[model samples]
Target: MTTGTHSTTAAGVARPGGPGPLADRTVSRVGYGAMQLERVREGRAAAVALVRRAVELGVDHIDTAQFYGDSLSNEVLREALRPEDGVVVVSKVGATPDPGGPRPMRSAQRPEELRASVEDNLKSLGVDCVPVVNLRRMDTGPGLRPEGDQVVALDDQLAVMTAMRDEGKIGAIGLSSVSAEVLRRALPAGIACVQNSYSLVAREDEEILALCAEQGVAWVPYFPLGSAFPGFPKVTDEPAVLAAAQSLGLSPSQVGLAWLLHHSPNVLLIPGTADAGHLEANVAAGAVAFDDATLAALDAVPSRSQDVPLG
Candidate 1:
């Protein structure tokens, strides 16, 4: 659609404010995730262009990690972004890339490791301070879990993160892959947002989502349409989702993303894609609307959780 402050649906309903407060800045709910940029086969030039296109479409919040292709994603952002662009780059820490190890990434959850990760992000992004840095806890995961010395205490991690925030190394603190109890305990630290694996079909973290909503913390779901990993259910594969997509003249993926936007006001999406068309569609998904009947039908679809092995 239009690159305005707010996006409107076909039904004429406006997305109030179009952007919400995160890390002391109001950012579009439809943001870009930079992980895919690490794997873009077209190479760095195309990846940079995709990032620029995202900014052109009014995306202000970009989520990334230093370990994503060993800081390659952040480097792409470094080449593509400028201070005048006014984009808030959010990064995560908790793991580091291991090219030769058994896994692609390994837990870096020690307090010192966390600090090094933040430093890596700052250096790679060429920023003095990260707008937001999410502390990706390995307590619960669809990915790597801490072991041996990697297992760090939450309070210890938060202490360092808060110190960084006070030192102006990071503007705000967020969390990922944490349980409701962990979030509840961490609420006093001023969590700006939470990145969790949640979707129309995989909503195991609904409690955590509700807690974030109640506490005014933005809920940024990682897999808004499920994962490609086996055992995980894709929202597009749901019959009701397909039917709704057909009736609305939108892709099943769009329908899935739209359902998340409509699910809660505090929910911010960071759907990732390397293709130009998919990038546009993900941003446009913010404006998709649904009638009450369709919304209810989509809502009625049973939520399922599958334990998929992840590194």
Candidate 2:
């Protein structure tokens, strides 16, 4: 797979520019998520193929994590793409899979643990220095708390990453599943992006989204298709979402991606899928255009929390 294989906007058509500030290079508004690739039916080989195809389709940003298949996704990326190829692979630390428990993951927030996570990601991706490392907050403590709940303070985590950055172990810092308040507090540390649970049907992070826009930080939303888990109502299940997709002659998922791109300049879509066809369809969603009426229809969709936000 190679860059410049295709253009999202057709000639003579007004191409929409990505909103908000990003890194120095041009990262496509649409990125590929590496989580599902780890669990693909065809396993690692299929995962590697999808990453290559995504890069070929101009997807410059690939969101990954060491916990995703115990660094399975990063390994696929290392095997598929060269580190010097210039695609931005953003990874996260702070939580790891709980192999012995029913819980999805357990926190690894200690400075030493975070340092080890960063090293694992670097080694898995075969890169000397990672472009970005997100301090994914695993929990906000036990209870129903307001936004920006901090189990582990941001300053302590950033301090460790700052030292690593100074040593050239990582490039910039980012946060995952953090609130606006937490973000404001972390301003002194400098943030490059924020990954949070947001979609047409999940709108709890509006303030966070608005904050990122105001601060010029990239907002890369995970679960953009609603929730990946079963028994959850997907974004496509919403009446307004279905109606708009039918009228616009696009799939509900495609319409969802288009809405996110139109929602804000800093909003970057990293929709993931295991199927090769689905991956192609996701890349094509970047080209799905919308006008004022369509945008309004999508905006009116009701918000519903599928489950508690994950790190």
TM-score of each: 0.94, 0.87
* Candidate 2 lDDT: 0.76
Q: List model 2 lDDT by residue over 1-311, tens digit each.
A: 11342333222211123322454444678888888886788877877888887776667778898888877888898999865445778899887767686665567777888999999998989989898899886433221222432355677888998999899998888888777788889867888898887888888889888988988789998889786666666888888888888998888888888888878878877888888788777877777778788788788888876446444
> Candidate 2's error at 55, in angstroms?
1.0
Model 1 per-residue lDDT tens digits across residues 1-311: 34454453222333322666686776778888999997788999999999988887778889999989889999999999988777889999998999999987888998999999999999999999999999999666477777889878899999999999999999999999888889999999999999988899988788888888888899999988987676778999999999999999999999999999899888998989999899989888888989999999999999888434385
Screening candidate 1 with a backbone cut-off below 3 angstroms (N, C-alpha, C), the clashing residue pairs are: 144-311
lDDT accuracy of residue 9 in candidate 1: 23
- Output the lDDT of residue 145, model 1: 74
The runs of at least 3 residues in candidate 1 whose Cα sits more than 4 Å from the true structure, single-residue gaps closed, are 1-17, 307-309
**Which candidate leads in lDDT?**
1
Off by over 4 Å in 2: 1-20, 139-150, 230-232, 306-311
Q: Which residue pairs does candidate 2 place in steric collision?
A: 19-265
